[model samples]
Target: MDAFFASVEQLDHPEYRGKPLAVGGNRERGVVAAASYEARKFGVRSAMPSRLAAQKCPNLIFVPPRFDRYKEISRVIRKIFLEFTDLVEPLSLDEAFLDVTNNHFAFPYATQIAKAIRHRIFLETGLTASAGISYNKFLAKVASDLNKPNGQAVIPPEKAEAFLEKLPIEKFFGIGKVTAEKMKALGIHCGRDLKAYSLVFLTRRFGKSGRHYYDIVRGIHESEVKPDRIRKSLGVENTFEKDLLTSSSVAETLTNKILPEFFRRLQQSQTAGRTLTLKIKYNDFTVHTRSRTFPEAIPPGSMEALALELIRQEELSGPVRLLGISLSNLIRPDDPGRQLRFSY
Candidate 1:
């Protein structure tokens, strides 16, 4: 899927087509959930501040998200993916990893399956999707974005080493801003530079993740694509148009606005957890989180009380940018005894 949320909006509302648009909080302090290709040309991007996006593109149209519609469409896309292979691992509503090694279609090449999937998605959903075909998840993920909307890129085993050598460290999966800066300081700016470090040296510097970095740099990711992945947490967060300036305002929003939606999702999923985490992002972009793990599942009405307590514990340094709550250590309604694995 390309510009998934924004594309869906455009498909449903013809007026938004070929125009700079974003789907998310349409406020000065809100964050963009997704940006259309037209918006991307003006330096707008997902997770960017709405105010900054407006500054970049004065005519930018901000539309509230329709998650239910997106989810419905995502299910349609998933159906198309399953037609090819059962070993499909969805990373999000829009993106997934498919192991076409033993596809049901019996395609001669993975690239053929990729093409067919993309074609079927467009035919069924009236939206475009870009695909990447590779031997491993990391390369496939990176290659997927090399081309734009309705395109596909493939990295064969023979070309993997050369492909990685020229790739920038920042573009590699799992490398973030802080890690990229650290790598740059150590003169590790590209895949070739990353490959220069021994496994022991990388582990010494980056802890458990260092080994992962080393393996990916040499095009050796061995993780399997597991299907029917379990969701570890259920959360809902909101960004205000105006920063919440007082403790009272923050608490009120959490109780009156966020909690209802949160509970609705929990009920819909029929999942609950003993651990509740509170997330706060300040206007300055600094974030802090606090969590409490109870011995039992969070009972009805207790979540709000616990959330309020968590809020009281944190010292608000400035006007708050975002407020969210997540419940982890989840157990399904039908099987409360079985605990789901928590993933960060």
Candidate 2:
């Protein structure tokens, strides 16, 4: 999907069409969850602060997120994908990777499968989609972004190496802003530059991920797309309009706002975990975390108690800006004694 959340909003609200629009933020506070192409022209982007977005595109319209509606549309899109191949690995509500090696339509070419899927999605959902067809996941993911809204790109195996060699290090998937900067500092500016380093050298420089960098530059990603990707953790976090100035205020916010939302998501996922983590972001944009793990899935009432305990243990370094609660070390359905027993 293209500008998924913002596109959906435009689909439902015709007045927003062709206008710079954003979803999930207000002019005064919050962050831009998605930005339409019109908004992007003015340097507006997803995850940008709403205030900065407004300053970038003064005419940008902000709309609250309707996740239920987005999910409904996502389900419809997934159904379309299943029509082509059962081997669909969803990255999020709006993006997925489909292994069409043996598709339901008996299509010999993955490109054909991509075109069919994109067409079906547009027909069923009235939205545009982009696709990247390639021999492997890494090249496919990178190819997917080469074209813009309603376009598709492909990188055959023969051309993968040359394409990767010229590609900027920053454009590679899994290389974030910080990692890209680190690579640049090491005189690694492109895939070709990265490929010049030995496996041992890369591993020494980048730790475990150095091997990944070495392999991907030479078009050597062998990881298969797993359709049933298990979620590792579930969390909820909130940024306050005003910084929380005291521990008492932080506790009050947790009691009244954060904890309820976290538990609601945990229940909705129908899963539990043994570890509870508390994440804090201070006004200076620095972050810290504390966690506790139990012998079994955390019991009812324990998450709240543990979260508060974690908060109390950490002396506030500065006025707090955000707080998050997460559960990890999940109790999977196949795990023995998976049933969660609640106790006060």
Candidate 3:
């Protein structure tokens, strides 16, 4: 799916086509959920503050997100994926990993399978999707994004090492802003730079994830794509239009705004969990997360009290930019005492 949320908005509202448009955000504190290519040309992007997006593109049109419609279209796309292989691992509603090694049609090449799936998606949903076909998930995910909206890229096994060696550190999956900066400070700018470090040296510098970095840089990712992945946690979050100035305001938003939405989703999913986690992002973009796990499930009515307690436990660090609440260690009705999680 290309610019998924905004694309859906354009598809339903013909007037928005070819215009600078975005989904999510208001003129104030909200963030952009997705931006059209037209908006992207103006340097607008998802997770960007609405005020910043406006500054970047003065004529940017912000449409409220219609998640239900997007999910409906996503279902159509997933069905198309299943036609080729049952080993489809969805990263999000709009992106997935399909292990077409043993596809239903006995296709000899993954690129052929990718093209057929992309064609079917456009035929069925009237939307375009880009694909990356490779021998592993890391290369495949990176390749997919190389070509944007209605394009495909392939990286054969033989080309993986040379391709990775020249790739920038920031472009590698699983490396965040802080890690990228840390690598830069260490004079590591590309995969070749990263590969020069020993496993022991990287682990000492980057904690447990350093080993992951060491391997992925050398083209050593061996993770398999599994089908029917189970979700580990579910949550809702919001960025405030105005900085939350006090604990009372934060508590109010958590109970009045965030909790109701969270519980509604919980009820819809019919899932419960023993752990409740609260995430707070300061105005400076620094984040803090606190969690509480219980032997028994916390009742819905008690959630507000627990959430408030969690908020109070933290120092009123700075005016909060964003607040979120989630439930993890989930137990679904059909899977008792079973917990499954996804790692990206």
Query: For every model shown, what is its TM-score relative to the native structure?
Result: 0.94, 0.96, 0.91
TM-score winner between 1 and 2, please give it: 2
lDDT of 2 by residue, 215-243 (tens): 99999999898999998998999888888
What is the TM-score ranking, best to worst? 2, 1, 3
Clashes of each: 0, 0, 0
For model 3, residues 1-344, the per-residue Cα lDDT tens digits are: 78999988999999999999989888766889999999999999998888899999989999999989999999999988998899999999999999999999999988888889988988888889999988889999889889998999998889999999999999999998889999999999999999999999999999999889988887778989978688899899988778898999999999899999998888787767889999999888889999999986666667778999999996788999899999998776777654433111
- Deviation from native of the Cα of residue 118 in model 1, angstroms: 1.1
Ranking by lDDT: 2, 1, 3
Residue pairs with backbone overlap in model 3: none
What is each predicted model's overall lDDT from 0 to 1?
A: 0.90, 0.91, 0.89
Per TM-score, the best of the predicted structures is 2
Compared with the true structure, what per-residue lDDT tens digits does model 1 show for residues 242-337?
789999999999999999999888777777788999999998999999899988777746788999999999679999988999999877656746
Q: Model 2 segments beyond 4 Å from truth?
A: 341-344
State the lDDT at 243 in candidate 1: 88
Could you tell me the lDDT of residue 86 within candidate 1?
Answer: 93
* Candidate 2 least-lDDT 10 residues: 335-344
